[model samples]
Structures are given as structure tokens and as C-alpha cells.
Target: MSVDVTWLGHSTVTVDVRDTTGDTGGDPAGRLRIVTDPVLRAGLAHLRRRPRTPDPSASAGCDLALVSHLHHDHLDLPSLRRLRPAVLVTPPGASDWVRWRLRLPATRVLEVAVGGTAELELAGGAVRVSALPAHHAGHRTGSGLSRAPRDARAVEHLVRVPGAFPARAETDLLLWAVGDTGEFEASDAVLDAAGRAPDVALVPVGGWGHTLGPHHLDPRQAAELVARVRPVHSVPVHWGTLHPVALSRTMGDRFVDPGPRFVEHARRLGVPGAVHLPVGGRLTLDGTGQGTR
Candidate 1:
């Protein structure tokens, strides 16, 4: 058994869990694909995707899609339409927005609040996704002072695949995505949400603009989170993806420096498993908690 992760760009990632031990009738390999916070387009507002745009095939055939908040960058409707996942999990108050924007039926869209869990049954095994607390603002306009929806809030997600490791039947493969959060003391709560230490963690290292607010984590702070969670493997995200069109030349370093800077800080803190994955890079994690790029 192994899990393959591909960082498409920004916060979007595709996690494929393969169960080689099971008998997948029509679907050989018994693979389940899950995508997170997909922003597939080349441009959004004043921001433009640097280097290149994401390939549509990267998010193709996704079983489930997870939306962290109501922010436009995290929950792009056009990108969601491209994937057309069988199930879409979003924050508590954003169900209606998803339904209205994507015209998806109520049966396909699920709203999971903090501490709430949603289970999905696959051909190979079962998956449990739990919503955790996030410190970032959740308004669509990116401002708390604006007239935002009362129930809108940001959340992190914990994805657990039962029996993913063939060697250890009692241990499950846990992947925690700390979506758009700041430096906070939620280590205990995050550990409790996953029921144990995470096998893999996808952490945000930077934001889109020149300045990151107090709600966002910088490179050093991201490394601190990795030290606390202590996952078997950690991948840095939310950097080196988008930037303002005018500042693409002036702020080039800001768009491309966080990932490497995080690796540096993680090494100083004696944090193992801090891997920096470039855009469209793929990493494979085997049953023994080892990874190959």
C-alpha cells in the first residue's frame, strides 16, 4: 500500500491512496483520489499564476473535493466545475453558495463543521474526513469588516484512510491539511482531531501578496507547526503559485522563496520530514513512512 501526493499549485493537491492488497473489480488498484482547495485557472482577479497554469489532468477523476473556506482563492467555482467531484465537502455555511454557484444537488454537497466528521465508503476501504479549527478569516471578500455571512468560517481537514498500510492493520494513514491558518496553539486539538499523530501534513508557508496578515503563517512559523505535529512526511504549500500581475517582476522572490525558506527553518528546528515540493511535483509515501519524489 502507498499514497501518492501531487502538488498542483497553491493549496490544491491531489492525494491518491492505492490498495494493492484488495480486489478492485472494475477499478483495479482500488485507488481513491481526493483534491483540496483547487484553483485550477491561470488567473484570478489581480493575481496571475506564475511559471505556468496547472494541467487539467492533474485534477481529473477526483472522487472528493475539500473546500477550506469561503475565500475566492480557496473555493473557486470554475475550478470546482472542472473536477466535478462525486462529493464536495465545504465549511458549514458555504453549502448554499456551492449549490448556487455550481448548481450541485444537496445530495452531492456536504457541509462539515468544526469537530464534525464525514465518512465515505470506497471500493477498497473507507475514508474519514474531519473538520478542524482554523485561525484565518473566512469572508469571501477577505475582510472581516465587510458584510460577510454569519456562519462562514475557515477550517482545516484531517483525512484518514483505514488499513492503508498493509504492514500495520491497526494503524491508519492520516493526512492533515492545515488550511490557511496563523501561528496558534492548536497542537493538542489537532492531534486529538486525527486520533493520533499524522502520517503526512500539508502546511501553508506563504500568502499571495507582498504582505501576509497576522492570520497567515510565515516560513518560520510553518516550520514550528511541523515540529509540533511531527508527521512522517511534511509538504509545504500555498507558495510559489500566484502573484500580482504588476509585481510579478518586482516581487519575484516573494512568490518563490517561502518553500525553500521553510526547509531551512525546519532543518534548524531539527524537524524531520519537511519536504519542499515544487509546483506539479509528485511524492510517493510507502507503508514504512518513507517518501520518494
Candidate 2:
């Protein structure tokens, strides 16, 4: 019935879903918590978290954790160890990478391919997580020189909470996480996979450096994707969080401008649902399908 979205910084987000209908007989276990692409550290390689570091307990008690790709920033092992979610989902061939780092049981790690779906049954209801295509390169890399085997892949995710209400329009809460990617012709397949527009879309608008490559979306391109998905609420992420330590003095603007620029572009495109959350800010969606800050 109600959903809370917390942006910890960069691609990391926490989605908490509550059953406002009181159908769980007052059981607290009725709620579901999901985390995505958690990077909960002070610094990573040449990048340092701007503004401040994320709280160490930010990933505590997550039910499901989703990794979009094998990239270091997205599939951070230290963060995953802190999270220790009940179930961990990753793009194809990533489960092995996760196992190599963490000692999680094979049953706890799942590899999902594009268009594949996984279901989590909770005390209150059920959640469906579907993997969607992403246009970014799949292999893990460091400094653009060293690379991992080209077996891993990147993917977007669609999380749907069903049985919210009796009405068809309000029966489900659809949250789409468009992981790191570039614009592509098949991007429209997201609509077909979701079957309808999502209630909230987590869109990435920038990267950790001064220049963005063709593999990632810039603010303007992110705004365009927001217009196409047309979710009831859109949260701009993957920016204003991390930047190269050496460029901190000279490229401060790059660290803080993408989220606001995405908001501005979305406004110009007549998509006012875009919400620019500061790192650690939260957005709540009430039972009536309205999003409030």
C-alpha cells in the first residue's frame, strides 16, 4: 500500500514496502525491504564519496539485494558483506563472482537472465523481480585496462508488489530500476516486460568521473528515458555521490550537477514527477499512489 524509497548515494537505494491494508494481522514481518547496487563505503579506488560517507548500517536487514552488473562500483563486495541479504540477485554469471568473494550459500545467490523473473513470498504478499536488458558492457574492469572474463552481463530490474488493492489500477506497486546503461533501440522492451508504466523509476543520470562514456547515460539522456517510462515518480541516481579524489578540487560541479540537471530536463519535457533527492534523502509513496517527499 505504501512504499518508501531511500537514496543512500550513487546506484544504492533502499525500497521498503508496507501493507497498509492491515491484511497481515498486525505482523511486522508483512513488510519487504529491498536494496540495489549498494556501495556503502567512504571511498572506492580513485573515487571518494562526496558530501559525506554513507552510514555503515545503511544496508542492514535488507531482504533482497540486486546487483546490476559486474562493475566494481555496482557489485561492491564489502557492501554486500554488510548487507548479507536473505537473497542476492545478480546478472547472469555474477553469482560465481559473488561466491568467489563472499561465502554465501549457493541457495542464497541467484543468477537471473534478461526477461527472467524471480518471486519472493512474504508474510503479507508476494513480490516479483524481473530482469531486463541493459546496454552497458558486461565484463568487470579496473582503470579501463584490466578486465575480467567476458561472461558476466548487465541488466535492469523490475520489482512488482502485487495485491496492494482490489482495483486494477492500484493492485500492484511497480518499481523499475534502470541500471547503468546507454540508449538503445530495444530499450522500449522495458515497457513490454513491465506490461505497464511503473509507479516509480530509479534512473541513473551520471557516472563517477568527469566524462561519461557511451555505456552510461548522461542527465539529458536520463531525462529522455524518464519521459518514455513516464512513471508516477522518478528518482535520479548514480550522481552527486562519488568522484575521482584527484578531481575533487577542479570537478566539484560534475559531482553535484547531474541530479539537478536531470530534474531540469525532465521539467522541460513536461515530466514533473522527477524528484531530485539529496544523498540520504527519502521519497514516500502513499496508498493512494501519490508520491510525497
Tens digits of lDDT, candidate 1, 158-255:
99887667676546888898779987677446788876779888899998888887899889998988888777788999888888887778776887
Mark the 10 consecutive residues where model 2 has the least summed lDDT: 141-150
RMSD of each: 2.6, 2.8
Candidate 1, which segments miss by more than 4 Å at Cα? 21-30, 142-150
Q: Which candidate wins on TM-score?
A: 1
Candidate 1 lands at a TM-score of 0.92
lDDT of 2: 0.82
Minimum summed lDDT over a 10-residue window in model 1 is located at 21-30
Residue 291 CA error for candidate 1 (Å)?
1.1
